[model samples]
Target chain A: TIVQTLERHFSLQDVLVGKSVLITAGPTQEAIDPVRYISNHSTGKMGFALARVFALAGADVTLVCGPTYLITPEPTIRRVNVRSAQEMYEATAAAFPKAHITILNAAVADYTPAHPATEKIKKKEAEFAIELTKTVDIAATLGTLKRPDQLMMGFALETNNEHEHALGKLHRKNLDWIVLNSLRDAGAGFGHDTNKITVMDRQETVAEFGLKTKDEVAADLLSIIVQKL
Target chain B: TIVQTLERHFSLQDVLVGKSVLITAGPTQEAIDPVRYISNHSTGKMGFALARVFALAGADVTLVCGPTYLITPEPTIRRVNVRSAQEMYEATAAAFPKAHITILNAAVADYTPAHPATEKIKKKEAEFAIELTKTVDIAATLGTLKRPDQLMMGFALETNNEHEHALGKLHRKNLDWIVLNSLRDAGAGFGHDTNKITVMDRQETVAEFGLKTKDEVAADLLSIIVQKL
Candidate 1:
């Protein structure tokens, strides 16, 4: 018991010493009006867990997240808070160049209101339509700018055709590794504290993980990254 | 010090004893698809505060609320959680007939997606439009069904034309009291724990309250209702 306690107390492995890591988390909100917005259910638990593990491993981490109540996992982590997909893209892009490893995990909105009204839109029309425009693709954009030394990871949350879609995104976005989580899986994705992930690499190698706490999943994910390094 | 401690320990006034109270709180989500939704910034602090105060006053409270992480203030208070505005309307309506006092505090959506996709909508189209249909007006419908002895209260959160908009809503919904909070006012409306409010009745009497914590505001509002009863 004493040995385990001692190990726990001084267990900083420093495996990623001198490494600069960038991570994005939570769900981006696209304002429809001054009061209303379009968003998803991401609570940033997975991404926050990833930041914590990476920090524990002695990496200098930068976490760019959307609006969420989740506290910064490590005081050392430089936290950048953004609201919209555009804001997230700008923040992530700015942090990407100096980072050794980049993780794109935020559930960024695909579309945003073409024109957010200055005032609250009154409820008058029987049928109202909100015109939407595609948000900038943060991962794909960063993928192009990635240097040979930089390792990039992306996440795909799919409701159907999970594997095919994830593989498509992996190649399309030019990621070194892709983590796939399905909404069909219970206790996985969005607001859940537990996750089941399948990590796929360019070699078509897939490593599947069982349902586990987000912290455990993060540690497993970090181990894979360390091996590649 | 001893008297103050005794008062704090035995503070239940039981002013609303044997009263049947119905309250709604939080922001109702309107589904755009399986994963995405449209919602307002309501955190339900004020409504939950009202529910807590009313429960402490010995009323039988049924709190029909929208999606929020806030816990039910009292174990004896019946809490019915609803997601969409339509669901909220049905739940509120069902509980209205038995209620002596009904408080429409939830920020119910005015519109909902006309046709929410069954699966996650893939990001393909550069430009998209979400067709929305007007949601049923819960307060107005309940107002028509209200008996002479019943009292109904409603909330108005306005960004512009604050007083006129709130007054219009109060008359249109046939509410006994309308509590107005403006977005322009700092520390008021939506997510804030503190609020500044203007209460108006059919007599055109306006009573403005200084900014205070939601719990204190709830007590003030209830005191007025007690006098009216």
Candidate 2:
């Protein structure tokens, strides 16, 4: 009782003083040329929201991000910007070993131009198809290295089979918790300020949440992580 | 010579004093919920560039846009922001008849949720699919109402059959000009500061331009339109 009261009286800093978190955010660009690339609509809002929440709670955060207009939400949160899936993987891998919790939130490209042209391709023919090759799966790759003490999380954004896909990814990636975003949620996905999410665990337990601003959602999400930690 | 000198001396406003231009920019969202949507990676950069160029050149420009984070480029240029393909179509339809030149630069959704749920959909089932229906064709809809002297331009961004698709769109949509953005072009597609394009006319005249900043490309495009005018 004394320890609990002392901890509460000290500050939020006392609660999370030694905890470290790593987060991956935004959309990775798959370059087709000097002027062309493939990417998603992620604006890095949710991840940035999470970073802000974690930083305010006195946890050290490292944010590895793709191309976005956003700046670091707090001075304490370290930021690393990357352009492609490969670059994101490298940065995340480098940061993973030092963190107690790792959240995979980036919409990294699944494929990239097989042969990006050196020069601008001209309109010689009426039709064309740029060959695409699969990219490295960042989550699965990092999952292999996760220790029992480290908490690993993954996110799934799906148009169909949302729960099945999320559960499958959770097991396959060895994630402790998986956040699922459904396109069926009208105001919940990409570029929006609000989100409704379902958090699934490795044991297949699921907790559904209501539509709320990403800031509120982030706090809710961090509380879940804090409980398990 | 004296008339030309007088027009030049008066101001840029004197040159395009009577010209009215309307542009559509950004990616149209197909809502599935109050908090979620289906959208592409259009940032409204190209359309905004065109609007900026026209406004600076002294033309009265109206910009009907979809959801994007970009701010209005110029104060004098009219701006309208909308979400969903239906909203975009209605706004564009209302503004179509008012301008002398209309440039359809928006990446409007081809399909939308056939039945959007009002409440946040709970993931009870393991697998599910959202049925989608075709959205209104913004370019073809306005093309039908084009006047003899009015110039209508369409933009086609394609991965396959670039020229053939663009040519078909030019005649089918009754566009005076069609700008083609091929994924094959190294630096000529979405979310990039630069572009390389091929402009095709209804008469089958094709003009190819090298990679350049969107601002420079916009100037080149406006010059091409000026020549025809």
List TM-score per model, in order.
Answer: 0.95, 0.67
Candidate-wise lDDT, in order: 0.90, 0.81
- What is candidate 2's lDDT per residue for B1-229, written digit by digit as tens? 2223223433334455578899999988766554345566688999999898778777899999997888898898999898778998998888888788899999887666788776544434433445567778888888899888789989988776778989998998889999998778777778888888999998899999999888777777777777676
TM-score of 1: 0.95
Q: Score candidate 2 by TM-score against the native.
A: 0.67
- CA shift of A61, model 1, Å: 1.0
Clashes of each: 0, 16
> Which parts of model 1 have CA positions greater than 4 angstroms off?
A1-12, B1-12
**Residue A136 lDDT in candidate 1:** 99
lDDT of 1 by residue, B175-199 (tens): 9999998887788888898999999
List the DockQ of the predictions in order.
0.87, 0.09
Best lDDT goes to which candidate? Answer: 1
Flag regions of model 2 displaced more than 4 Å.
Answer: A1-18, A24-43, A53-60, A64-68, A74-98, A102-229, B1-13, B124-127
